[model samples]
Target chain A: MKKLLATILILSLVLTMAVGCTSDKVEETKSLKVTSGLWSRPEEQQFIREEILPGFEEEFNVKVELEVIDNIEKVMEAQKASDEWTTDVVMTHSGTMPLYIANEYVQPLDSVKDSLDITFMDAFESATTQDGKTYYLPISADVYLLIANQKALPYLPDGADVTKLTWEEYKDWAINIADAEGAKVSFPLMPIKASQYQVGGIGLSYGSEFPMINSPGMLSAWELLGEMVKNNAILETSFNYDNPVEQMKSEEAWLTFYHMVPVGDIYSSAPAKYVVAAAPAGPNGNGSIAGAWGVGITAGTNNKDVAEEFIKYLARPEVLYEVAAGTGGFIPPVNEVIAQLGEEPKDIIMKKGLDTLENGVVSGVPASEYTDWGAVKSVFDTVFQEMWDNDGELAKDFLDAQQKELEKLEK
Target chain B: MKNKYKKWFPYFLLTPALLYYVLFWIRPVLRAFFESMTDYDGSFSLMFFSKVINESMFTAALRNSLLFALISVMLQFTVAFMMALLLNKKFKGSNLLLFVALIPMAVPPAAVAILWKTGFSTFGWINNLLITLNLIKEPILWMTAKGYNALLFLILIDTWTVLPSVMIILLAGLQNLNKEYEEAGLIFGASRFQIIKDIIMPILKPTIITAVILRMIAAMQVWMISVMMFGYGRVPFLVERIAYYTDMVPMLKESYKMSLTYSVVVTTIVMISVMIYLRVNKKKEKEVRI
Candidate 1:
C-alpha cells in the first residue's frame, strides 16, 4: 500500500511536468492566431522565432499564436457552424486576393488604416485595393530576373546586353554560346516549381498573357526553346531548377532565370560568380512576373481590434526591414523604406530587386496570372516534360491544350 | 433484466468504436462520393466522372499506380520473406540485424526521399564513392535514367523502406507455425524442401496474403520518390495527381471528383484483390476435426 502511494506520487509529478512542457504556447486568454504562408524556408526561422514571437508578445501583452500552414482551404462549413474565425490574420501572396474576395475570408483594411504609418508603393497600393477599398497591407515585393555568370556574357551576340536581349537575340545568343564554347545555356525547366513561372514570363515577352501560350509570339518562344533542345543547347544541369545556386557553383549552368528569392540566395553564397539583370523585353513589355505578398485581418476574428493592432505593428518599416533582411529576397513595398534601407552591404540584393521591381511591375489581377492556386501546374509541367522527352516537338498541340486548361482556371 | 443487460452489453462496449467509424470514415467517404458527382454549386452530374475517365493524365497515372503496386508487392514480399527466414533461424546477432533492418521504417518518407536524391546528385556521395573505387570513367545520370532502370531504382528504394515491416509480419507467421508437423515429416524420411512446400506454405498462405494486401495499399500511393528524384511532371502516380488537384490546385469541384474517384478505385481494388486471393486458397485451407 505504501509502495503504491509512492509510485502514484511519482507518476503524478511526471504527468505535471509533461503537461507544463506542452503549455509553452500562448497562455493568455486575449490571444491572436496569425496563420501565415510565408515560412517556407529556413530563412524564416530566425525572424519568426527570435524577433516576431517575442516582440509581438511583449508589445501587445497578448500571446501571439504564429502558425505556418502551406495551404489554407476555404473553411465554409466551419465558418458557418462556429460563426467565428479561428484565425485573426492571414499572410499570403497576391494570387490569393481573388479567392479571399470571392470567399469573403478577409475584411477591408479601411478600418485599420489610421494606425498604419508607412506609404505604399504605387503598384502595392493598387494591389491591396479592390474597388478602391484597401483589403490588405503589402509585406514585400518580388519579381523574377536573370542571373548570369560573368564568364558566359562574352558569348553574347555583338553588343547584346544581357538585360536587354530581344527574343531573336536571346535565341541566337544561347545557340552561339552552345556552338562556340560547347556549353548549352541553362534554363530552369522544373515546371511544377519555378520553371513554369519563368515560362509565364517568357510568354509575356512574346505578347501572350497568362496561360500565355497558343499565340504567335508563344510559337516563336517554343520554337526557340525547341531549337535549343534539338541542338543540345540546354545543359543537363539547367533542366533542374531546384538548386540553381549549386548549378552556378558547379558551372554546369552558366545562365538561368528564377525568382529574386533564389537570386539573393545564390548571391549571398557567391556574389562574385553571377550578376543580376532585368529580364529582356518582349514585343509588348518587359515580361516580369511581379507580385506582392501581404497580410490581412480575417473576417472571422472575434477581437478585430487586436488583429488590427498586430497588422499595424507588422506594417512598420523597421519590422518590414527585418523581414526583408530575414527571409524574402524582395523589394520593400513602402516608398520611404526603400530610401531608408539605402545600399548597405546586405541591402545590395534588396536594392537590385527594387530596381527590377520598378522596371516591370505588373499590377493587381493581371500580375498574379493564375488567381488562387492554378491547378494546371502539373499538367503544364508534364506537357513540357513530354516535349523535352520528344525533343521539344510538343509545340502547337501541347501549348493549345495547356492554354485551354489555364483559361478554364482563369474563368 | 440481467439477461437483457448481457445482450445489450456487447453493443454498449462497441458504441465508441462504431461512433468513431461513422464520424471519421463512413461520413467522409460518403461525403466525397456525393461531392464527386456534383458541380461546384452542388448540382449532381455524371460529367465529372466522364471527364476524369477521358482525361489522358488521369488514365496514365492510374495505369502507373496499378503497375507500381503490382511490382512493389512481388518484390517487397519476396525480399522480406527471405530476410524473415534468415532471421527466424535464431543466429548470433540476429536481434541486432533485425534492429538494423527496421531502421528505414523509422525514418520519415520525406527524409528518405531527400537522402536518396542527394546520393543520386551530380557530385553526390554515390559518384564520389564510385570515382574512388575506379568503377567507371564518367558519372551516371541517375535522375534521367529512363525506362526500366528508373523503375528498378524506385522499386529498390521503396522495397528498402518497407522491407522490415513486411518481414515482421512474415516472421510472426513463421514463429506461430506448429513445429510438430515438420518434425513428423522429418521422421518419416520426407525431404526438407517438400515439407516447406506442402505443409508450411499451406498454413502460411493466409498470413502471406494479409502482408501483401497491407503492402499493396502503400505501394499504390508512390509519389514522393518520383517527385524528389525525377523532378516535376517527369513521373506521375494517381494519388500524387489527386493531391496536386486537391491541395496545390484548389478547384473545389475537380478536387472533390478526384478524391471520390481515388477512394472508390482504391477500395474496389482492395476488395477485388482480397476476394481473388481467398478464392484461390480456399481449397488449400485445411481442417482436421474428425
Candidate 2:
C-alpha cells in the first residue's frame, strides 16, 4: 500500500513538470526570411540587399533575412517535408513555380488578391493563376535574346535584321560571322539540368509548348542546332569556354543567345557593349522566350500575414521598378515604370529585352506540373548529348524512339 | 540483487544501439523497399520497376557505372599493389612517403573533388603547365571531352583520392605475412620472382580480394565526380541518374521505384561477385590443404 502511494506521487510530480515544460515561449519581435532559386550575382540580388531589406527593416520595424538558394532541389525537398519551411516565403522562375503550386507547397494569395496592383502580360496570366487561385505574382522579367559583340555586327547578311530574322537567317548570320574571322559562335549552356529552363525557349520558337516536346517543330529545331554544331558554326562540345561573355572578349566566340543581364555588362568592360536582338524566329513565330521570378508565401508558414505584407511592399510599382532596374529585367508584366528611371544609358539592355518581349509572339506553353515537362526536358538534353557523342549525327530511329518515350508522358 | 542488476545491465547498455540500428538503418531500408512497390497515393503497384528499366537513361547509367567500377578497380588495384610492394621495402623516407600518400584519405570526398576541379580548370595549373610545355596551343576543356576521354580524367582523380587507403590494406597484409615461408623458398634455391608469384600472391589472395571488392563497390557508387565534373546527361551513372530522378525531376514516386530497381541491381552484382570470390578462395584453400 505504501509503495503504491509513493508511485502515484512520483507520477503526478512528473506529469506536472511535463506540463510546465510544454508552455509556449512568447515571440516578441517578428522576423521573416525569403529563400529563392532565382537569385544570381549583382542587379536584383544587389538591390534586395541594399534597398528592400533596409526598407522593410525601417518600415515594419521587422528584421528580414534574404537567403539565395541556388539549388532548386533543396527548396523543393523542404516543401515536400511536413516540417515548417526554413523560410516563410519562396520564389522561383515562372517555368518552375507551377510544380510548387501543383504540389500545394505554396499558399494561395486569395486574401491579398486585390492588393496585386501590377498588371501582368497575357503570357504571364496563365503562369500566375491555377485552378482559380493565384499561386504566384509577377516580380521581374528575364528574357533571352541574341547578344552579339559589335565587331561581329558587320557580318550580318545585308537584307537580314537582328530584330526580325528567320532561324535560317540567324544560322546564315552565325556562319557569316565565323567566315569573317574564323571565330566560332557561342551557344551558352547552363551545363546541367538547369539548361532545360534556358533551352526550352528554343523549342518555343518551333511551336513546341509545354508537354509538346516531341512535335515536328521541335525536330526541325534540334536538327538545325545539330547542323550548326556540325558546321563548326557553334562551339564544339570540347571547347575551352567557361562563359559566353568571356568567350566574346577573347574573340573566340562573338555571337550567341543569352540573358540580357550579363550581355549588358560587356559595355563597361569591353570597348563596346553587346547588341541584344530577338532570338531567331522559328517556323511558328519569333517571340522571345521570357522567364520571370516572383515571391509567394509557403503554405506551411506560421507568419502568413507578415509574409503577405512584405509581398505587398515589394509588389508596389515604385519598388518593382527599382528591383527591375537592378535586376536588369524589363520590369514586371509591362514597362510602365521604365520612364521613372530618369536617364541611364545602361537601361538599353532592359529596353531591348523589353522590345523583344513586346514585339514577338510568346509561343511557349504555360507551366504545369501535370505535364511532367521535366521528363521531356531530360529527353531533349539526352538527344543533344547523343548528337555530341556521334560527331553531330542523330539517327532517325533514335529520334523516333525518344519521341515515342515523350509521347507516353502526355496527359 | 546485485547479480540480477548485473545481468540486466548489458541489455540496458545495448538498448540504444539496437534502437539506432532498427530506427535508422533497418526502418529506412524497409520503408524504401515498400514505397517502391506502391503508387503515389500508396496503392500497391509493381509497374514502376519495369518503367524504370524502360527509361532511356537507365541503360546508359548502368553501363557507365559498371564500366567505371571495372576500370577504377583495375587501375587502383594495380597502382596500390605496386605502391604496397615498394613501401614494404626498407628504404629511406618510406614512412614519410606513406604519410604524404595518406593525406588524401583524411580529406572529405567532396572537398577533394572541389580541389581537383580548381586545379584542372582552363586557367588552372594543369592547363597552364600543358600550355607551357607546348603540349597543345589551346586548353582542353577536360569536363567536355567526348566519350572515354572525359571519363579518363575522372578515373585519375578518383584513383588519386582512394589509392592510399587501398595501399594501406595491402601493406597491412604484407606486414602480417610470415617471412618463414619466403625463407624456406630461398633455402630451396627458389628465385625471388618464383617465390613471389607462387607463394606470396596465393597467401595474399584474401587481402587482395578484399581490397578489390571494396574498391569496386566504391567505384560502383561513382557519382559526385562524374556529376560535378561533367554534368547531367554528359557522363550519367546509376547513382547520378537516381539523384536526377529524385532531386532534379519531380516524379517522386517514379524516382523511388527507379531507386528500388537501382539498389536491387547494384546489390545483386555485389552479392554475386562476393560469392564467386569466396567460393574460389575456399576451393583454393582446400587444394592447398590437400
Candidate No. with top TM-score: 1
* Model 2 Cα shift for residue B206 (angstroms): 7.0
- lDDT for each residue of candidate 2 in B84-155, tens digit (9 for 90 to 100): 988988699999998998998888777877777766765556777899999989877664565677777888
Q: Give me the candidate number with maximum DockQ.
A: 1
Report the number of the highest-lDDT candidate: 1
My TM-score estimates for the predictions, one after another, are 0.88, 0.78
Per-residue CA lDDT of model 1 for B1-290, tens digit only, reads 99999999999999999999999999988887787677768898866677777767676667677778888889899889889878888989999999999999898778888788777766667877998899967766576665556667888888888888899999999999999988998999889788877777777888898898788878877888876676544566777776666666565446657657666666666677767767766644534322
Model 1 stretches astray by more than 4 angstroms: A1-29, A73-82, A150-173, A176-186, A236-246, A249-251, A282-285, A342-346, A361-373, A376-379, A394-402, B35-46, B146-149, B178-192, B231-233, B283-290
Weakest lDDT window of 10 consecutive positions for candidate 1 chain B: B281-290
Give residue A33's error in model 2 in angstroms: 4.1
TM-score of chain A of each: 0.84, 0.80
Candidate 2 chain A: worst-modelled 10 consecutive residues by lDDT: A237-246
TM-score of 2: 0.78
Clashes of each: 2, 0
lDDT of 1 at A321: 80
Please write out the lDDT profile of model 2 over residues A1-411, one tens digit for every residue. Answer: 999999999999999999879979844667888887765664557778887678877787678888886555457566668474767888877776777777777888877757665565566767777888888777777676677777777888889887777788777777786666654677655343434434456666777763444567666666777767676677663233334665665555678776666565553355345566666777767645577786788878878888998888887777777676656444455445655554353466666666667765553334444345566666666676677667667887888887787676665
